[model samples]
Target: MAERITLLVGGRSTEHDASLHGYRHVLSRLLAEPDRIEVGAVCYVDRAGAFHLFERAPWPEREEVLLGGQTLGPGAALERLRAADSFVFSLLHGNEGEDGGWQGLAEVCGITGNFGPVLASALAMDKHLQAVLAAALLPGLRVPRSLLVRPGSFDAGQVLRRLGPGPLVVKPNRMGASLLTTCLPEPSPSALAAAVREVFPYDDQALVQEFIDGREFSCGVYKEHGKFVDLPVAEIVSSGFFGHAEKHTKGRAKILLSPENAATRKMRAFSQSLFEATEMATFARFDYIVEGDGIWFLEANTLPGLMSGSIFPMMLAETGRSIADLVLSAVSECGSRPARDKVLAYDISH
Candidate 1:
């Protein structure tokens, strides 16, 4: 029997649009493999957190057509998906989608797919926590000096004194896509405070880190059967940091695939180690900053973007693998794994 798969996209997160765009590509790829796979549902979650099922993959240019479907509650939607006996491939990024909420829900409901382990998703979501984990677990891995601060509770003067002079990057501690993220060349106390305050509207906490001036690169990894498979390292060439605009806007960032260099070689090795150490399942994308001999750990995306021109798909393409291959492999892997026992048995009679 063909493996049934559900493509879950969009969410209440700020990355909802990107998810919608990515799912179009995923759906197209999955549909191509008619004999081996069956696309059971193309579930779309709106920004307001309502669930809607699209009978077909909506055209990338015609996102407005999404409103045509009758809205269903989350419970109703999940129940429908559960009844189909389909494996879910979530394309949703950030917030409840990426931060273990959706993964936990699926686990509880016995629905599984490319969504990774719950703890791994949550760990990858928090920048500060990931940094701390990397520092403690991966010796010799250079993580930028960072401090977690909340609006109106952190002092800018102390931040500068600890992280060093001037140049620093301020970003929401838990958000992705560089939304509201800023870099200050010459950060004054007032300017730093203002930058941190800007993050408060979107996220409760902000991460202020000493900026590393160097080349940016990303490597992807996934488990095939029980072994780890690392993809080619790609260098991201941009004016400065690869911010939201550079990522979404076409031709803004130049991606060089399989760059032959020492930094990339080391990155591939580090990526595999990190993936295993963090218990990341399915697949993940790890970003880094290379300064001469030092490779600084930037962050990891458990749910990497697959939108048109997204980096993950580009890396996959370099290896002659498409989204279809990834989806099929993930579904098989999910099936091969032993099921988790949610409840513990006790000897009450003794």
Candidate 2:
């Protein structure tokens, strides 16, 4: 008998749609391998933060069938989740889903989800914290010179003075998919202030870093056996800024599989080290920038998109790995441990 899988998609985050797209791709891949996969159920979290349960529905293709359903409140959803003997695949992006919120809940519920533990998820979700940790753990690694801004204390003048001149990248500290990411060619004090204000709606904290003009690349990292495996690196050749628009649009950016070279090798090494330092497990994608100076860490994605044009899937394909490989690996790692026993088992094993 095939193992059952409970795929969770959609969240009350900015990347809710991205999660839905990822679920579509993942669902299609699992359906292709019926002998190994028995998609037992799917739980959809609407933008309004409502949980709806669907029975005998493993496939989600239409809006009516996908969005319209018997509303199962949080208590019922958790009950169904706990009742199933399934590997929970949290394909959520952005805030509550990927930012250690769900991971913490899983821990409290004595369940171990697909992503890493709560600490790892939280660290990776906060870009500023991750950068600080990376710098401390790997002293030789290069992180961009930047300033961290909080909600009440966004001193644009002070930030500019410290970061120096123009072309700074302002981004939300805890969000992904490049949402609310902006590149100001000439970021005056007013421009920086406006950027911070623009990002305030998404996150309470924001990061302002000196924008490096160089090649942007992303590498996928997954843990197997007892070590981390780095996938082929892919460079993003974007016509303009590689923000949310460029990320989702198919033709906006060209993803080229970077050959094994000094730069690519360095990126892979850094990625593996970062994964270890951040305590990331299962799998993740680390993005970087290479300029005349050196390779600089951009940010890490704990739950990267598995959409048709997502970079992680493209990079895995370069190494002859498919979404099936990822799914099977997750299933094998999660095993048949019951949700109520996972935390205790994890404690004993560690």
Candidate 3:
């Protein structure tokens, strides 16, 4: 029997549009392997957090097809998913989707698939916390010095005193895709304050860190046959800080796959180490900044983008692997795991 899979995409996050774009590519890839995989449904979560179920794989080329589905409430949505008995692979990014919110819900409702462990998702969401944990877990791990700033509590003078001087990167501590992320080369008090303020609209906290002037690279890791398989390391050459525009806009950045270098080996090792240490499920991608021999840990993505032109897919392609391989591996890995015992046993004393 073909493995049934339900793709969960779109979410109440800043990356909703990106999720939709990624969904089209992933859906197309999965549909191509109908003999081996059956896409039971495409569950779409709108910006307002409502669930829409598209029973038939319409192979939506545009976003409009996502609108023509039966809207479902949370309970109804869970029931629909449970009815399919399919592995739920979430493509949702940021916030409630990637930040342990959906994972926690799936755990509570006994929904299974690729929604990673709740604690790991939550840990990966917060940049500051992830860095702290990574540093503690891996001795001699180099991460940029950073400070967390919350609304109304940001002080530029204090930040400068702590992190020091120019070329600081300020980004939403919880958001990804470089949205609302900025690098101030001449970080004045006002400039730093404005950058931190921009993050407030989308996220509760901002991470201000010293910019690592080095070559940037990202590597992906996934499990196959109960063992870790690390993909080739890809180097990202961006004109600037690899912000939203640079990430989304073609020609703004160049991605080189499996670059021959010493850092490549070190990055793959680091990625695998972090992937295991954080208890990430199925798959993950880790970004880094390497200056000479010193490699700095940038961030971790439990759910890395799978859209066309995304680094994860490119890394997979370099290894003769496709999205289908990843999905199937996830199914096998997750399916073999022990199911959660949700039942509570108790005895009433006579």
- Pick the lDDT winner: 3
Task: Please give, for residues 1-350, the per-residue lDDT of candidate 1 as tens digits.
Answer: 77778778888998888788888777777678888778876777888988878654433224566654757887888887677677888888999888999889888776777777899999999999998887787786899989999867799998999988858999998888888888898999999999998999889999999989998988898766677666788889998777778887888999988656777878888888878887887789999999988999999999888875888888788878888778878887777877867689878876
Q: Which lDDT tens digits does candidate 3 get at residues 1-350?
A: 78888999889989998899899899888888888889988888888888888877564446677766899998999888766778998899988888999898888777887987899899999999999987897776699999999887778899999887769999999998989989898899999999998889888899999999998888888789889876788889987788889999999999988656677887788788888877788899889998878989999999999999898998788778889989999888877877767689999999
lDDT, candidate 2, equals 0.82
TM-score of each: 0.94, 0.92, 0.95
After superposition, the stretches of candidate 2 with alpha carbons farther than 4 Å from their true spots are: 336-350
Please list the Cα RMSD from the true structure of every candidate, rounded to 1 decimal place. Answer: 2.1, 3.9, 2.0
lDDT for model 3: 0.87
* Model 1 local distance difference test score: 0.83
lDDT of 2 by residue, 102-196 (tens): 88777666454585577888988899998998788777678999888988887888998889876999999888989889999999999989999
Give residue 126's lDDT in candidate 2 (0 to 100): 90
lDDT (CA) per prediction: 0.83, 0.82, 0.87
Clashing pairs in 1: none
Cα deviation of 41, candidate 3, in Å: 1.1
lDDT score at residue 167, model 2, on the 0-100 scale: 93
C-alpha lDDT (0 to 100) for residue 340 of candidate 3: 62
